[model samples]
Target: MRKLTIVAIAMMMIVLTACSEGNKNGQGAANDNGKAAAQGQDAKAGEAGSDAKQEPVTLKVLRAGITVTETEFNAYLADAIKEKYPHITLEWVEAPEDVEIEPLITQGTVPDIIIASTTAATSDYERLDLVEDLTPYIEKYGVDLNRLKPVVLDTIKTYSPEGKLSVLPLSLNLPVLFYNKEIFDKFGVSYPKDDQSTWDEVIELGKQVTKQDGGVDFIGFDVNGPRNISTGLDLNILDPATGKSTLTSNPGWLKVFNVLKKSYEVPNYIGADGRYQYANDDDIFFNEQNLGMLAFNLAHLIGPLEELRQQGIELDWDFAPFPNFTENLGTNRSANVHALLVTKTSKHKDEAFQVIANVLSDEVQEKLARTGRIPTIQNEELEKLYGADIPVLQGKKIENIFKTEPRKVIKPHEFESDVRKFVDGAAKRIALEGIDVNTAIREAEDNVNKELQTLQTTR
Candidate 1:
C-alpha cells in the first residue's frame, strides 16, 4: 500500500455509535446536548425558524432514519425543531433498520425531508429519481455556510455534483485505538501509544499478551474488521479518492491478517455471550475484556460503558491513533460518511434548512464534542456544550479526523451493507480460521465485487 494508505488507516476515524439511528463510525463519549436538554430549556441560538418564514404555514417533511429504541437527543431535537417553528410540523418518518426504504420513496410514502446516512445510497435512489436536487433552493435560502467546519463543508461537497451539498451532516466520531489500561497493566506489557504504528507491532503485542485470567481468555487485541478478522481493511479498505477495495492489493492487508489472526483456532476476543462471534464490533471488545486492543467507532464505546457503569461494572481504557500500515503512510483512517439530505417533498424546505443550519452550529457541535462526537461545524471557538466551561473541539483534533470525506461508492446496491459484512467475515476467517491470507482476501474481494456487479445488473 502507498504511504497515504497507511496514514489513512492509522488516522482512520470510527465516526459514530450512540443514540444515533445508524452508522456511528466512531466511539461514544458524553452527550453535551443531552445534558443541555436535561435542563429543559431551549438554547439561546435554537432554530431561528420564525425569521425565515414569511407567514405561518405547516411545512411537512418526510424523514428517512431508523426508529431508534431509545431516542435521546434525537427525540428532543425533533421537539426543539418543532418548537422553533410551530408552523413546521416535522414528520419524522423513520423505518426499521433491516427494511429497504427505497420502496417507500417509489410509492411516494416517503417523508418530505430525510435525515440519515442511508440516503447516501443516492446513486441507487437517483436511478429511481427519488431525491430532488435542492441546489437552487439552497442558494436562494442563503443558509449559514459559515457555521460549518471547512472539512465538513468539503464532505458535503463530495455528495454534491455541482458544488451543492446533498445532506446536512450532524455527528461523527474520530476512531482511535483504545486500550484496556488494567489489562495491559496486569499482563505486564506496556500499552501501545502513538499517533500511528505498523500492523506488525500490533500483532507482536497481541501475540505476547493473549492469555487466560481467572478462566477468562483475553485476546491481545481485536478490531471490528469487515468480516470480523482484524485485517486492517476495517480501517480503510477503499480509498476516498478512488472507489475501489484495496484488500488483496495492499501490503497493510497482509499485516492486518498476520496480527489479527494471532490464534489460528480462536477469534481474538469472545463475545457478550462468551462465544467468539463477529456481531456488533465494539460490544465484544468492551463486554468480554476478551480484547485488549480495539479499533472501533468511538461512540460505540459509550453505550457499553454506560451499561457497565449502571451495573456498577468498572471499565478501564484509553485510546491512541490507529497504527500506520507503513511509516510513510503517515495517516490512516476508517471512514464513516454521514449525510443529511433535504427532501424535495418537504413543505417547509425553508424552515428545515434553518434547523439544519443549527445542526452545524458550534453551539450544537460543542454538545457533540462532549458526547465524544467529532462535530461537522468544528472551529477554534467551539466549546463543549455540556458544561459552561468545558471544551469539545479537541476531540476532533485527537484522531487527526477533521471532516466526513465522501468515499467512492462500491457497486453493491447503495443500500446493501454487504461490503462491510464481507470485510468483517473475511478478516475473521483469515485471523481465526487459519485461512490463507491471500485466498481469504481474494474471496472477500470477489464477494464484494460480485455484490457490486449484481447491483449494476439490477440497475
Candidate 2:
C-alpha cells in the first residue's frame, strides 16, 4: 500500500511541473506581441510625420503702381515664395488706372495683400479702412522689427494714430540727384560735387550750365515736383489736428516755394512760351539728354534707365546724393517706402503675413537688392548689392543713395494729396506769374480751405 501511495505523489509532481512551464511560455508570447504592436504604431507615426505638409492656399496680391509688372513679380518675389512655402500660390492683381478699390471691395474680391507706396497707405488704404493692424501677426510669427530700417518703421507707424504697424516695407524710393554727364560736358561745366552739394550749391551749379547751344536750350536743373521739394523740408500740406492748410502759416512752406522758384528761375529754363520745358514723362535728362541735373526718386528711374541702356540708347549719366536743404544738410527726403500690407478682409491672415515675412527674409532682400530694389533691411552687405544686376550701374556712384539719412516722417493728413495740387499751382504762379512767396502761399491756403470745405461737405 505504501509503494502505491509514493507512485501517486510522483505523478502529481510531474503534472504540476508541466503546468508551470506552460504559464511561463504564455507570458513570453504576450510580451513579444505587445512589443510588436508598439513598434508598429511608432513606424506608422513616423510615416505620418514625414508626409505632413501645409495646406494648399492661394493668395491674391494687388500691386498699386504702374511700375510693378507680372513678369517682375515672377522673377523677383514669386519664385522665392514658391521655394519656401511650396503649398502657396500667388495671384497677381494689377490695379487698373480707371478702376478703383471700392468696387473690388463690393465684389468681395479684395486682395489678400496690397503692395503700395507709403503715401497710398495713409491716403487711400487708411481712408477706405482696407488695412489691418499687423502687430499681432508680427509678434506671433517671431518677426524681428529690429531687422528693418528705423526710418522705414517710423514712417509706417506714423500712418496709424494708435501706433499700429499696418504695413511691412518692401523697398525704399529714396531721392537721388541724377545728372546727364553729356550735358555738363557739352557746356564745358564741371560736374556737380558728387553727394556733397546742398540744394543752394546745386542751384548755383545749375545756373552755370543753363545756356543755349546748337539751337537747343539746355536747362540747368529741375525737380520731380514741388511736392518732392516740400517733402524734404518735412512740410505737410494740412495740419492733422486742425485739418487746415499749412501753406501760409508754416515758414517751411515759404522755403519750399522759394526753392522751387530758384530751381525754375535758372536763366532760360522756361521755354519761349513760358512753360516748364521738361516734362518728366519724356525723361528729358535721359531721352533728350538736355537737362543737366534732376532730383528724382532713384527707384523710379533706375529700372527704366537700365531698360533704355539695354535698348542701346546711351546717355553718360550718373547720380549723386539727393541735394539737401541748407538747414537740413545730410538729411534725406521724407521716408518713401514701398510696402506690403495684409488686408482686414483677408481670410488667410496668418498665411499672408507668413508670405510677407518671407519676402523680408535676408535671402529675398539680398536678391531684391541685386535686382536694383533698395532693401529696407539694415544690412551693410545687402546695401552694397544694390544695382548689382544692372550692368549700367557698375562703377557709378551707387552709394550716394544711402549717403544721407532719411528725415523724420511727417504724418500725412488725409487732404495732403488734394492740397498738393494747390501748392503746385502756387509754385507755378511764383515761377510764371511773378507772384511773391507770401502771395502764392496765401492764394494756395485760400484755395485749399475752400477745397477742404467742399470735400467735407461731399463726404
Q: Estimate each model's TM-score.
A: 0.69, 0.85
For every candidate in turn, the CA RMSD to the true structure comes to: 9.6, 23.1
Alpha carbon deviation, residue 19, candidate 1 (Å): 17
Model 2 regions more than 4 Å off:
1-53, 97-99, 161-163, 277-279
Q: Write the per-residue lDDT of candidate 1 for residues 372-445, one digit (tens) a residue.
A: 45566545433333212112222323433322232222223232454667776776676546587778878988
Q: Pick the candidate with the highest TM-score.
A: 2
lDDT per prediction? 0.51, 0.72
Report the Cα lDDT for residue 10, model 1.
22
Q: How many Å off is the CA of 70 in candidate 1? A: 6.4
- Tens digits of per-residue lDDT for model 2 on 13-48? 333333334334542122343334434533443353
Q: What is the lDDT of residue 248 in candidate 2?
A: 73
| Candidate 2 pairs with clashing backbones | none
TM-score of 2: 0.85
